[model samples]
Target: MFDVKIVNGHILDGTGNPWTKLDIGIINDTIVEIGQLKDAPSKETIDAEGLVVSPGFIDTHVHSDLLCLRPEVHKIKVMQGVTTELFGQDGISVAPVSSETKPIWQKQLKGLNGDIGDWPWESIDDYLSYLEQSDLIGNNTYLVPHGGARTLVMGFEGRKATKEEMTEMRKIVEKGMEEGAVGVSSGLIYPPNIYSDKEELIEICKGAARYDGCFVVHIRNESNKSLEALEEVIDVARITGVRLHVSHFKVAGELNRDKFTKSLQLMDEAREEGIEVTFDQYPYTAGSTVFHSILPPWMHEGGTEKLLERLKDKDVRNRIKEDFLHNEDYENWVRNCGWENIVIASVGSEQNKEAENKNMLKIAELWNTTPEEAAFDLLLEEEANITMIAHWGDEEDLIYGMQHPLQVVGSDGIFGGKPHPRLFGTYPRVLGEFVREKGALTLSEAVRRMTGAPAQLLRLKDRGLLIEGYKADIVVFDPTTVKDRSTYEEPLLEPVGIKYVLVNGLLAVKDEQFTGMTAGRVIRSGVATPVN
Candidate 1:
């Protein structure tokens, strides 16, 4: 008798193979058999009569490390059919942080991570061990956040690393990898990390590559500096011979819209030059980040207290606002730039909880001031804690980009209330809308993108496939009904049509409901190439 038998299902087998009729048998947490199973007996039998079973979806980009410590880990993501997720993208994470720096790190990332209770570890390995003890509901993976590590070793000051500092940083990456972090990640567009030049990155990539890990970067900026950032990433890959994964590789702002195709051409060119480059982007045009991210790097050099001091100085505030005025859209007094479309995804401090859905642009208009000044004031009032969805994407660009072979789907999601629906709907949106509904990709091809492609990039062994001996991580859904219900307004709504989701062979989500089970394991990269 089999431990569990899923009978009469259309198996999509994550290999991009042709769909086949099969009965999958699971014994404990592994798929024990496939194909005909007419007489198979088991402790449990699921009559998957009309369901289309595929490998459980894997989210390549997630910011759920600290948030998953919450009681439910937000069942919204699990119910949407994501069985496994890679956390620590764009560099901010709980691991690799010393206890002394954890609080400051938490506060700095509060807008992105939302408020969470105290963390238990000061290092990546310890954090992973603590997570293993948590009542998590789904599979969670870890990445050594370069920003977190840098902040721990050097604080938030923008400076070049000393020789000893470089040694310390390399040790941090090595320790995290030894403890199960899949790779190294950076947020170069954000804080102290932005201070790092190409040579520093090359050194760090070399360390990560020693652990067979990849380097993932929230590339410098997709604006005027997009090409420069791309050049920097390619240089790192070239210098260190590391694998490069570009996070949210979109060209933002209307001015950069025409540069989207050019960005792809650049990446393709890098690939041709033997630089292993891949990128992930959400299907949305507008991007979301902390409002404080717009602050000058110098203003944020010392941390929150220093930033608050600068905010209090009228001269400093005016000087900063003067610089921001050149941005045009936000310079016009009382202009509601993207307000109608800007949904407040998260608010970090107790004082700013009321700003969760109110528009910053509208608030600027109410104060009869420039949007930049309004943003500064709002962030200052909340201690630089706010999140906003900037409406700045072109649908044509999104569609065209997703069609690219090297482009994989990513939500770039924050685990917070009213967060971008991409967190809950990315995989299904690609599977149902883009693949089935729009006919942009064959179902097998889409599955490969969400499953195999990312698994390969992260170098997760034996995952992202449906082979008999592989892990029994699977999903069963109805393609016709598998549509994302979470819209821009009702961003927290759950998706429909996913019937079951398994992580490491245990049902994490069943019948479109969370089973309150976590069967995830941290994946450490074993490649010897530099990970960028």
Candidate 2:
């Protein structure tokens, strides 16, 4: 008898091809057979008559490291049919660290990931080992965080790395990559990483390229100089011959939205010049991140302790206020952060619960002050640690981005007490809202973008496609009924029409509910050998 049989489903196969009817047979953890199975016997048979059976979704950009440590994180992702998630995004993760840098990183990243209790592991392999022993939700792939590596070797100081310090950091990257890390990541817009120059980046990325890996970067800026940031990324790829992937690619400022065509043309021009480049973006019109991201980059050089101290000085505060007023696109930034569109999603301080769903502009008006002053007071009151959303980007910008052949999808949202809905609703919104309802893309093309495309980018062999002898990581869903129920007001609701989600032939989500199963394993890269 077969181990399990999913009968009579229209198979999409994840190749952007036409749907074909087939019966899928699974045994242990692999797809044992496909096609006619009329005479096959099985332990259990699922009647998926009206459902579309395809490879489980793969999330390209994710920040669910600590969130997945909680048991229910898998449920939130699996119910939307995501079987695998790429963690260690935008250069922040909990690996490749030293004891000295652990506490400093925890405080530096307080606004990004809240309240990390303990340092569970030291190296990338060690961190993955800890997750393997814990109750994780799905398969996780990791990358060596360049920002964390810098913090470990060179504290939060804004200085160039000496020869010895550079060597130490490169050794850490080599060890993590040897232990199966996919690549290295950097967040140039954030501190520590922002302090690094082109020489430092090129040296490290050359090592990553030696292993046939890609370096992913959250570009230096996402606002007025976004095009220049894109060019800089291309320059890095050209200098080191490292494959490049840009995180959350979008034109953010209101005036910059008109330059989408120009930015895309530049990317197209880069690809033609033989620089391998790809990008991921969420489908929403509004973007979200910590409110302090608007601060002048230099003001955040020394990390949180120094930032808090600077916030208390009268002269410094006045200087910062003047700088905010005189910013080149200050009005566009204000419009992007519309009071009604900006929501207080999470806060470290207990006093912040009352501010949820309220906008920064409204709060500023209530206090009879400028928005920057209101933001400063709120951050100071909350100890420079709060998470807020920016209502930026136009719908046309998002649609134009997705229509590109090279673009993939990702949710920049991460979880805390209460989080943005994209973490739970991104995949469903794409399939239901854009493809099924709005007809933005055909069903076949949407499946390809979610599954096969990202898997190919990660070089995940025997996954993201349905065929015999491959891992039985699959999902069964009804395209017509699938929809995302989560919104800004209520961000934790589950999606509909996803009936079954499997990881390695085990049911992670069954009947639209999580089974609390934990059978995920960490994926590693192939070994690098010397060229003759």
Candidate 3:
């Protein structure tokens, strides 16, 4: 007898093809059959009469590095139909650290990745092993973080790495890949990573290339110098022959919106020249990240403690204000999108909790000070543990990017107080608004982007497709009524019309309610074998 049988559903199969009426049979954790199985005996049966059955969605970018350790909080992803996620994004995460660098990274990443207290894991192998032993709500994978490696070798210094340091960093990356990292990632706008030049990046990409791993990057500048940033990574990919994946690709700011088309042209040219380039984008005009990211990179040279010290000095604060106003060399969020467009999303301290969900301008008015001063005080009070959402791109640009042939869906979701609505609504919004309402893309194509495309990119041998003998990770939902209920004003609301979700042949979400089952596995690169 089969372990479970789901019958009478229209199967999309995650192949970018039209749906076919079929039934799926599961035995243990594998999809045993996918044809006529209505009369087949099974231990359990699900009647999915009018639902669409497709492979469970894979989130390409997420900040769930520590959150995954807490399934109660991490189930939000499964509630939205995401059964797998890629972590170690933006070149900062919770692995491959020396004991000396652990506390420093912990403090620097508290705003973006919430604090989970001290753990005993240091290397990528240790971290992955910890996940394997944890009660995970979904499958998790990781990329070796560039900043983590840099800090491990040299303690957050902002100078160019010497030849010996470069060799050390490269070896760290190679070890991570050997320990089962799918790729290497760098956030060029963040500290330590920002200190790296093109040569450093080339050396690092070569390490990833040795294992045929992708080089995923959040390029240095996404505003006025976006094209140059894109070209910089493209050139690295060219020189190192590393497969390249750009993270949350966009041209931010009103003045830089016109550069969106040219950015796509560059990507197309790169692909034409035989670079395996792809990108993931959230379907939104506003982007969210740590509030401290708005400051100049130089200010973050020595780590969070040093950054806080600089923030206390009057002269340093003034220099920061000047740089925010006139700096084109770094990403100047204040100059591109004013303080009015930057809204505080989360703060760590109880004293600063009132600032959450308020724009910097509003908070400034409430404090009777300039917006810059208000932000500085908040960062100081919260110990730089704050996050913000900035309204940057246009809806038209977002749609155009979504329609690109190489584009895939990623929520870029960060979990915390008054977080971005995309955290709760990205997948549903794409299905309901982009597909059912505006017809921007067919439902099949949308599912393909969320499923098959990311699977191909990550080189998952058996996941991301609804085929016989594959893992039974699947989602069942209604196309007519699926919609995202979360908004910027009410960001915690869950979605509607996701009927059921299954992970590893077991029901994780049955009839729209989570079953409290922790059946997830830690997927290592090139280690997953197809279930026969």
Candidate 4:
């Protein structure tokens, strides 16, 4: 008998093909049959009349590294129909940490990934093993963060690695891939990763390529130097033969908007040259990240603690202000998008909670200080745990990227106070606004980007589709009614029209309510099962 039967649904199948009317039968954790299954015996049956049953969305980029360990808080992703998520993004995350570096990473990542008190695991294998024992709402995969790997060999040092140190770092990454990381990810705009030169990236990519792993990166620059940044990573991929994926790919700042087309042309040229490359992007004009990123890379040289110490210095503050105004070498957030366009999204301290949704300029006005000082003071008070949203592009540019053949959906969601609405609304927004409302993309094509495309990129063997023999990771939603309700003002509001979701064939969400059943497994590279 079937474990669960879903009948009267239009199946999209995640293959970029038009939908077909069908019914699905699930037993245990796999889809046992896909046909007319209305009379199939089952423990539970869902009448998915007028709903689209497609593969549950795979979030290719997320900052849920620590949040995934906390079952209650992390269900937000699954609630929005995400059945699997990729963590260890932008070259920094939990896991593979030494006792000495663990505290440092905890502070550095607190604003981005949140602090869950103390982490109990120290390696990729240990971290995945812990996830195997946790009550996870959806499946999770990881990348060997370049920053974390570098920290294991050298504790957030900002200098070139010697020959021996380079070999050691490569070994660290190779070991992580062996432990089941899908790839290696680096955020070139962040510390440790920002310190790495082109040669260092080639060495790291070589290690990941040994396991046929992909190299996912947030390239060095996304504004004025955007095209040059793309060329750098493309060159690394060419040298190492590592599968390359860009994270939250976008050209930031109004002045840099014209470079978007040229960037796409470069990616196309690389593909023509037989270089395997792909990218993920959220459907938003603004970008979000830790507020400390506004400071120059040199300020983050010694890690979060040293950064805080430097922030307290008058001379350092002066240097930082000068860099924010003039630096074109690094990602100058303040210069690309003004302080008025940069709004505080979240803060770690209750004392500054009122500034959550206010722009830096307004906050500075309230504090009766300069915008730079207000930013510095906030970082000092919060000990560097602050998140911000900077308005970067227009909807026209967002739609242009969305229509690209290589693009996939990744929320790049950062949690905590007045978070980007993409955190809660990304998937539905695409399905509703882009696909349904605007006709920017067809429904079948949109689902493919969120499902089959990412699944193929990550090398998930049996997920991301609705084939009879595949795992039953599915989402049932009303096409007519599905839409994201979350906004900048009401970022916590849940999306509408995602009626049911299944993870590993277990009903995790029914009628938009969580079933409290944690059937998620820690998916590893080339395998759908947990690490054993």
Model 3, span 1-532: residue lDDT tens = 8999999999999999999999999999999999999999999999989899999999999999998888888888998899999999989988888879988989999999898999689999999999999899899889999999999988899899998898889889888888889889999999989999999999888888888788989999999999999999999999999889999999989888889999999999999999999999998899999999999998999999999989999999999999988989998899998999999999998888889999999999999999999988988999999999999989899999999989999999999999999999999999999999999999999999999999998988889999998999999999999899999989999999888999888898988888998988888887322111
TM-score of 1: 0.93
Per-residue lDDT of candidate 1, residues 1-532 (tens digit): 7777788888888777888999999888789899798687788777788888888777788887777666475676678777677888787777777767878887887878777677777877677778777767667777888877787778987788886777778778777777787778988767778787777787777777777778889887676567777888888988877789998877766666777898899899999999889998787777777767666666778677688778888899877766554543211111223445555667666765665665766666767886666676777787777777767668889888888999877788876656777877877787778888888888877877778888888877777778798888888888778888777777877788888888778877778888778676655455434334
Model 4 weakest 10-residue run by lDDT? 523-532
Worst 10 residues of 1 by lDDT: 328-337
Tell me model 2's lDDT, rounded to 2 decimals.
0.79
The digit string of per-residue lDDT tens for model 4 on 1-532 reads 9989999999999999999999999999999899988987889999999899999999999998888877778888888899999989999989789999999999899999998898999999999999999889999999999999899888888887776777888888888888989999999999989998899999988888888889999999999999999999999999989989999999988889889999999999999999999999998899899999998999989899999998889999999888988889999999999998999999999999989999998999999999999999999999989999999998998999999999999999999999999999999999999999999999999999999999999999899999989999999999998999999888999998999999999988999988898999999886323232
CA lDDT of each prediction against the hidden true structure = 0.76, 0.79, 0.92, 0.92
For candidate 4, the lDDT comes to 0.92
List TM-score per model, in order: 0.93, 0.95, 0.98, 0.98
Total clashing pairs for each candidate: 7, 0, 0, 0
Error of 2 at 265 (Å): 1.5
lDDT of 1 at 383: 79
Candidate 4, superposed: residue stretches over 4 Å from native: 527-532
Sorted on lDDT, highest at the top, how do the candidates line up?
Answer: 4, 3, 2, 1
